[model samples]
Target: MQKVDAVPKTNKSYTVLISLIVALGGFLLGFDSAVISGAVKGITVYFEMTDSMLGFAVGCVIFGAMAGNLLAGPLADLFGRKKILIIVAAFFTISATWSAMATGYTEFIIARIIGGIGIGGAILIAPIYIAEIAPPKLRGSLVSFNQLNIVIGISVAYFSNYFLVNLEGESWRWMLGVEAIPAAIYFLSLWVVPKSPRWLILKLNNVTSAQKTLSKIGGAEYAEVTISEIQRGIAKKEEKGKISDLFKNKYATIMIIALGIAFFQQITGINAIFYYAPTIFEQAGGSTDSSFLQAIVVGLTNLVFTLVAIWLIDKLGRKPLLLIGTSFMTIALLMAAMAFNNATYNFNDDTLNKISDTEIKIALADLNGSSFDSQAALFSEIEPKLNQEQFLDFKRNQITNFIQINATLVLMAILLYVASFAISLGPVMWALISEIFPSRIKGIAISVVGFFNSLVSFSVTQVFPWELSNLGPTMTFAIYALLSFCAILFVYKFVIETKGRTLEEVEELLTRK
Candidate 1:
């Protein structure tokens, strides 16, 4: 298990400090992932790409994250957790510099993918490290530090992106390059924290070193009990972890729980909102500035609600939070769909008057008197009237002129959806994955489940741009709404409450069946 056993109240400060340092990795994960939201428009314009290509560019990092997830577990198990985190920090630094300096589309994709590797490694290892080091009494809160940092990072990214949006052609570069500062800090900070005591004891059989580390974590008595527990736990293990060992019938129940939670988290379209927040706002009749401002609000809402989740997670238990959050998510998504469902775009006299830009006004001369039932229809009507250059500019600014809907309702729905997600699946998935699996196969099990999680994230992010153009907002969000409803049922029926339980106890309870 990643977390230490029960410790005295006095020494718990050390545990919190180390957990905070490792959790910085999650901050980088959030910053790197969401910074792309602001850059989407600029990158598309700079790369001169089509909808499918834009989707590929946006989602490519998740593909790299998938690879990183596959490798992080075994590597962390083999090498030490601290060393792997240092390596991940280096990856983040290099990826930031390389991506900012990229001159071509291919180079940009490669750089983002590299950063994604760091994101994946950091995402899994930090939580595992926190779990390993934290005492059982504080395990839930400490492990959630990773998620807290993630949302904090996302909030910072949104604020950064919002402020940097005025930089015109170079804003995306600045937004991405800022990550190097935190990456360097995280890298240098790793030296101060000790390696995982569990790793030293179980993998290296260095009980002396483990004892010292555990003593630092808790106290002498606490260390003695924890070490004894570790020894007893290891004695029951049949062998070292194998890939096939994860699927043995004894482990199947826990495996299903891990895989299901991972799958459900991404399929609910959370990343689509995160990766494309500004774009979503723009599609709902917001200006570039308002979109960026609204993105900041979303970020703040996420940050605030994540704190709420951290406070309540151990108190309410995992299954209750899942049930509550998914229920809210379902309602919020339907609210989003309903908001978009009533939208209509038309080139009436009022809309025509709103087009102050001379070039855009001239471009829309032929369609001045036309009315469109939807944004898609308006876009289709305008598509044939302009050249590629004019088409790009037109697409960017069209919603400002003709959209007729309650834009505030859409924003509120999205914020509600984000708030619900932040308090539940956003942080809970990582916590649950770290908790549910048996220690023997924990590393590989997390890697496999994380791989599938990134895979789904990749698909959702990559297709979101296309989905916006083809399926439209109403249909796209309606699908997510339905899925959210199903997720509530899945959690209520299949998921077990795991708060306040030790990793060993949870493993035994779940797998005994």
Candidate 2:
């Protein structure tokens, strides 16, 4: 029999250092997920493709992520977190190199999907890896380093995209190729980090090595009792349970909660803003040349606010941030509606077209009004209905204006959403996941959550563009904002707070009737 202590005595600084290596996976995840912004427009121009194809090219990574996240748990369970981190980092490095070299639309799409595998693996692994070693008091903050890295990665990608695209040649290729440096750094760090002790004891059945790793993760005084308690938890599970037990009522509630957390994170449509940011900015009445610059601003906002989230989560805890963030998001969504309404209604007026046709004419020279009138006459003479080209041009202008207003609104919403996510859906979800599972089922359950989360991410990423284009941006975002509202319902009624609770303490709470 082993005693389960209330907490582990780990040196916080050393433990966080190790977790940061795993968190590097997050940096790659953010970069790969977002770097598509720089390439979307240039890729379209280079390949001479359509919007639908462009969406597919960008969204295919989410599809690949579905499979990667599904595999993350089992692989991490079997191989240990350190080994898997190395593998994911390698996948990213290769994918980056290949993506940069891709010549055609199909090749680029394939490369993006491949990169998504790394993204999925990184997200699933980082939290699990960090949770395995983190002390309860520090766990939330430490795991959140993953989100912090994610924002940094997004900002870096944005900056890199801007700088690289300035080169005289194909700038998108350079935008993608830079990810390899970070991936390589992540891989090198894993060599020195110790494997998760809990993983060794429970999954590998190696007590001595587990104790050795635990002694370093926590101090020796801490590791002795902590390691004993961890094994006891595993032993208790071995005596009384099976994987199917997770489907029963006690565990089922937690599973539903975990799934909801995953779904709402994506349903907020944050990724949509990230994915189509430049395009959204372009629609907002900006030139193609300026869209990337706006994207950089969005990325910077994401980074700055993410740090705000990291600082706030441990202090204020998770739920409050979520409440504040979602409320902000809802208001932002309404404002977006207002912006799009302006764009949708203001399309194709003859007055606007007359203003654009004066190429070299003086600003004070109002004589060119007749030139648009003549062109309008010729267009009407040919078809008699509203001229298709002029109507499309008008719609484009309106869309640009609409996009501009909505995008500005979206940026504010995204900032709030990012802050909220950094605290709640971002870090707390993973903490709760680790907390809910009994030690015996931790590996499998983490994998299951990872699978479902990744799959939801894939579905949301793929469906949002079509929904936005067909249903209109206002409707699409409104639907996502609505989902966030529904998520509030789920959390209020069912969620259990896990902050500052020990592994045993959290598990016992789950068992309560």
Candidate 3:
């Protein structure tokens, strides 16, 4: 192994092309996560789901992702990253097709869970692959391509939902099944990209193949240097990392940072917003069409700001972005909380006419021209007037007609919150996780933290609808606001800057802390 005086110039176009193809998995993951938002109304009606049931249907994908997170790393290590990614693509294709055609509740859930498995694998594996292949100079930006594709997928899903919303019967089916075309394309695209060079060297001891792949990414000299580094890193490790190794005292800081970022990322309500964007807007008195449009705006904001993050991540460093992003996220959430807090539900004659259910319309006639200060107050006055089914229907569908809110303010707040997240937690967490771990424990540690991240995402998505119904939007947004504030403090106290540092340099720096 020879020591190199300078970092080799990489074959930039080649590295980027491979990264873009692999990151397509992130696009699929994003699409699968968000397409369901458009389908929510249809599925709730089609399945005749209660609040809890609706939550389960929406959150089940995360449940499947948990299984994927657990399985993806070990399988990638045993088989190879490229092969597992192909399997992930197949899972997405199957899940999309099956979920679209599913007529029964149980069947729909099964289909979604299968897709969730793909989501789990794609979300973890794509960045890991990108990180492994990328030069340190380009690592942050290239790895962020996964996050960029995610936001693009999300934006596309919103547009797809809006376009397909009027498709005769079972419009949700079209919205969901449309994903199959892209998923199949992704499956085929995986065939062209090379396996992770690190995986080739580490798992199969195929130095020649690894060098060939690396040579394509950089040059022969770059390949030689990188291979030497990988070999040296491997030589220093006595054994492969076990699950127990993550709990060691020396790794405590890494574990804390990983777990905290994982926890805050989801717990701050990003997924809940992504999964239920239209619903949140609708709660603020938006019409269905307007809500969908606003959701698209949210997606676009996310996409644009994610691009900004990519540009700044390697420039401004991770901690500053987290600090700045979390501060704005807190403020935006507070804006939303205040907007919802000041909202009033008023049932006038015009508002009553919007209720399609005649029985419920007549039942609510007595409350005509009356206004309530809050959703809880409004629900109290209306609950005893109707039976359980009617009440649920009114809450889900009709309440939007009567609410008087600052719709523009709510929209602005949501967009700001999303933009803040896009620049900060959304891409940075995965980037940090990929960079900070020791090579020995990296795979298992990521899986553990990813599983935790998915678990938090599931809980937030699962309980969101219930919170809107029970705690009301004001309290729900306020809770997120508080969490966002706490996130800022955590980053300030714990997270270290990792800008422009090699993975080995980052590990050494953090290990000393």
| Every model's TM-score | 0.95, 0.86, 0.98
* Model 3 TM-score relative to the real fold: 0.98
Error of 3 at 305 (Å): 0.7
Model 3 lDDT, full chain set: 0.93
Local accuracy of candidate 2 as per-residue lDDT tens digits, 1-513: 443332444356678788887888888988988898888767876886555676678888887787777777778888888888888889899889998998887887787778888877888778888877876677777878888888788878877877777787888888889999988998888899888888888777787887776676666766787777786677667443445776878777777877778777777777877787776666556666577787787787777777777777767877676666666666666666556554522223343343353431222133223232222232233233335544433333333532224456555654555555545566567656766777666766777777777777767777765665456665666776687777777777777777667778778777763
Worst 10 residues of 2 by lDDT: 370-379
Off by over 4 Å in 1: 1-6, 353-366, 376-396
Question: Against the hidden true structure, what lDDT does model 1 obtain?
Answer: 0.87
Kindly give the number of clashing pairs for every candidate: 4, 4, 0
lDDT of each: 0.87, 0.70, 0.93
Please list the residue runs of candidate 2 whose C-alpha ends up more than 4 Å from where it truly belongs after superposition.
Answer: 1-10, 239-243, 344-414
- Report the number of the highest-TM-score candidate: 3
After superposition on all CA atoms, how large is the RMSD of candidate 2? 5.3
**Count of backbone collisions within predicted model 1:** 4
